[model samples]
Target: MAALEPERAKLDTTIPNESRIADYFLGGKDNFAADRAAAEHALTIAPELPALSREGRRFLRRAVRFLAGEAGIRQFVDIGCGLPTQGNVHEIAHSVAPDARVVYVDHDPMTVVHGQALLQDNERTVVIEADARDPAALLTHPGLTSVIDLDRPVAILLFAVLHCVPDDDLATHIVTHLRKAIAPGSYLALSHPVSDLCPEKTAKLAAVYQAQGTITGGRRGNLRTKAEVERFFDGLDLVEPGVVYTPLWRPGEETPHRPDATWVVGGVGRKPRRPREHPALT
Candidate 1:
């Protein structure tokens, strides 16, 4: 694989980025004290955040395995892919399908740089510095174009990233555009932070992220109701046991049950060969 070098010198270590902070929560050594402090503050507001992160990660692994092994998905476009952690999308996907191709997209310089470094020897993977809000940019990137065949079935991974998108319409637009770009049989695996699970505590953490100059901006984290999340997949065919808590989304092993308000919701939907046209699309 050719090296896709990023301008790493431009990385700003002063500010706490979502990717690095997430790395902190995952118990990785790539984060700084500032990131750790912000993560700790976030925990103060929502004590189960670390656990939520773990569950979310687990959900991602399970989803990717299903997509590659069971769903016969060979291509993956992971948007808002944070810093490379254990059981990353590419690793899990390739484990089942050795030929599976993955394109990771994120605007964070650190994530792009580190991901590129980690994926250097993997010709089947590519990392592009692109924001999830701009699906066009991501779709048109050389790296994405090189790895993902848009006209074929692909799994679009939006795991734990929609919270960064505050504009409801833009969030919808991003998914709509990407869905249009892919052929039928494509899949969308999404996991988002939900305030309904722990409204007060989640809101408090949202405030901390806002104060930390993080991209989340205290913008309510777009913590949607379960029905609203279902709205995002209006035209797609939802998989079995649809739109449940992250741990409950096809939990392979028996997971310890938490309170009803667990702060995260996840689901996978398949783009039918003939999906109903939505009024919103017109």
Candidate 2:
């Protein structure tokens, strides 16, 4: 537990942390009064916030399963991973392939503390504290590099995290770095809140996050249009039904149907292998 002091120092009971607020939305016990209050405030602006959070988790589960089962990905770098919750990346991935390795990265210190505790016994998973916006540093972090080999096919999970990376240019840089690092056939699965879904309400939600302040290590939140979100998948081949609303992305029969207003768009895209060059005219 000595290693947790750094993250513990950053904890403030007065201001709600994004990860803790998200934990509250997911009905997890890892939150404080400030988080609950913030979530309640968000509800007044967008009553479906809780449901949207759940739908986001469902999309994450489905995306991870698809990567592990169908895409044959054995290693994962899940950036901006929040607090440990039910059906986490390792659990979902391991269910499909027991040998899969996962490294969970987050900027929130508490998330790293809790995540580390959650996966301590699981040899296949490790949690590290790092900002997702700096893909270069995160991708090269010793904790992540120790578990995932960049030369091999890997899946980078950005689910529900990109919106927290406010700067569009910085976001593009993050994706570009990731794209350049991963081997061909790697995947990027992301879910971002879109403005087009419910512009007025979503704007209010963004305002709520902005007012909450960035007590954590990253941006509060930023709602992007569906087109803006789609651009994150620029160099990859989007899977079927690309960048659709969360529940609409390859939902299983059991996945509950959510209203279109939920507005969080998600998709999984694979980096295709570059074609080999032919020999010069011989």
Best by TM-score: 1
Question: lDDT at 155 for candidate 2?
Answer: 96
| RMSD each, Å | 4.6, 5.4
lDDT of 2 by residue, 137-190 (tens): 788899988899999899999988777766667677777778767888889899
Those runs of model 1 whose alpha carbons end farther than 4 Å from true positions after fitting are: 1-10, 216-218, 254-261, 280-282
Instruction: For model 1, state the Cα shift of residue 124 in Å.
Output: 0.3
For model 1, where is the 10-residue window of minimal lDDT? 1-10
Clashing pairs in model 1?
197-261
Give one digit per residue, the lDDT tens place, for model 1 in 192-278: 887676566666666677667665312554366667777777677889778887778887775734627566888998988875685
10: Cα error in model 1, Å = 6.1
